[model samples]
Target: MTEQRLAGKVAIVTGASRGIGRAIAERFGAEGARVVVNYIQGGEGAAAAGTAIEAAGGEALAVQADVSQSAEVRRLVRAALDRFGRVDILVNNAGVMVAKGVLETTEGDWDRTIDVNLKGAYLCSKEVAPVMIRQGAGRIINVSSNSGLYHPSAMRFTEYVVSKAGLNGLTKAMALAFGPQITVNAICPGWIRTDMVEEIDPETQQRILDETALRRWGTPGDIAAAALFLASADADFITGELLIVAGGRGMH
Candidate 1:
C-alpha cells in the first residue's frame, strides 16, 4: 500500500463546508490527516463533510466558528487541539466577494469583506501559530485570489481584491515572523468553478475561458492539490511564496 503523505497530521480548514474549502478538507482527510472542517453558518454542509471523511476511513471534526472574530477563532483552535492534540496544518480558506464597484460598494460591504477575508486569516494564523511553534513544525496556507494581483478587469471587486492583496502581505509577514518553525504561504487562484463564481454572467465566463490558456475554469481540486503539496514534507523549504494556480490567465 502507498503511504499517506499527511499521516498522523491534523489540519484546520476554515470555511470548509463548501467549495474550495470542502475540497481541501476531503483531500486532506484522504491523505490521512485528521481534519477540522470549519463553517460559520453552513452546519449541514460541514457535518456532511465530516461524515464523508469518516466514511473514507479518516478522522474529522466539524467546527462552527466565525473566523473573523478572535474569540471564535480561538475556540476553533482550541477545539482542534482538544480533539486531535495538535494542529500541523492551517488552511485559511474562508473568503467572500462583493459584486459592487468601489463607488457602489457600501461601507458595510467593504468592512465585511475585509473583516472576513483578510482579518479572518490573520486571526486563524495568530491563534494557531504558538501551538505550531511549540510542535516545532507547521504549515499555513492562505487561499487568496488572482484579483489580488494585476487583473485587467477586476475593479468591480474592490473590497475583495484589497482583502486578498492584504492577505498576501500577511502571508509574507507571518512567514518572516515564524522563521524555521512554521511555513506561511498563499495560493492565488484564478476563476475557479466555485459557488463564489457561479454568479458570473455567461458572457464574462466565456470571456474568461477564451483568455485562459487551458480554456476552462480552475477546479477546487486544483487548489486542494496545491494545498496538499504545500502541506507535505516536499514543501519544507518553501515559505512566504504566492503560488498561482490559474489556468494560464492568472488575472482576467
Candidate 2:
C-alpha cells in the first residue's frame, strides 16, 4: 500500500453518494482519512461509496442528511464525531442545478435552488466551524462553480448561478471568521463530465468543450484532486480564496 498523506485525519464530505462529491470522498479515503459520506436521497449510492472507501483500506461511514436543514446538518456532524472522533476536514459538496432564464424562473425554483446549494453550505459550515475552531486546526472546502465567477449569457441557469455566487461570498466570510486556525476555500469547477453534465444535449456539450482551452471536458477526479490539495497541509496559509478549475473556458 502507498503512503497515506491524510493518515489519522477524519473528513466529512457532503453529497458523497455520487458525482464530484463521491469522487472526493473516495480520494480522501484513499489518502487515509476516515471519511463520513453524507447523502440526501441515494442510500444505495452512499453505501456503495462507503464500501469502496473501505475496500481502499480506509474507513468510511454513510449518513443521510439534508444539508439545507439545520437540525439535520447538526445530526450529520454529530454522527461524524461519533464515528470518527474528530472532523479535520469538511467538504460542502452538496448542491443542485436548475436551468432556466431569470425572467422565466419561478419562486419555487429559486427557493429550492438556494435552499440546497447556498443554504446547505451555510448550515453545514455553521455546524462544523465550532468543532474546527475548538480543535485549533481544520479545513473547510466549498465546492462552487465557474458559473458563479463568470456568467455566460447563452447558458440559462439563473437560480443555480445565483446560489453558487452566494456560496463564493460565504466561503470568504467563513474564512475570515475562523481564521488563524482553520483555512476555508472554494473550488469552482467547470464542465465536469458527470451524471449532471450528461443531462445536457450533445450539441450543447460540444459547445462547452469548444469554449474550454483544453477543448475537452473535465472529470470528477479533477475537482477531487483540487479538494484534496486544499485540505492538505500544503494549503495551510491559504484561505478565503476561490480556486477556478474551468480549463480556461471562462477566461477566453
lDDT to native, each model: 0.93, 0.91
lDDT of 1 by residue, 11-53 (tens): 9999999999999999999999999999988999999999998
What stretches of model 1 exceed 4 Å from their correct place?
none
List model 2 lDDT by residue over 89-161, tens digit each: 9999998886667899899999998999999998998898889899999999999999888658435888888
For each of the candidates, the C-alpha root-mean-square deviation to the true structure, in angstroms, is 1.1, 1.2
C-alpha displacement of 252 in model 2, angstroms? 8.1
Q: Give the Å error, residue 17, model 2.
A: 0.4
Tally clashes: model 2. Answer: 0
Candidates in order, TM-scores: namely 0.98, 0.97
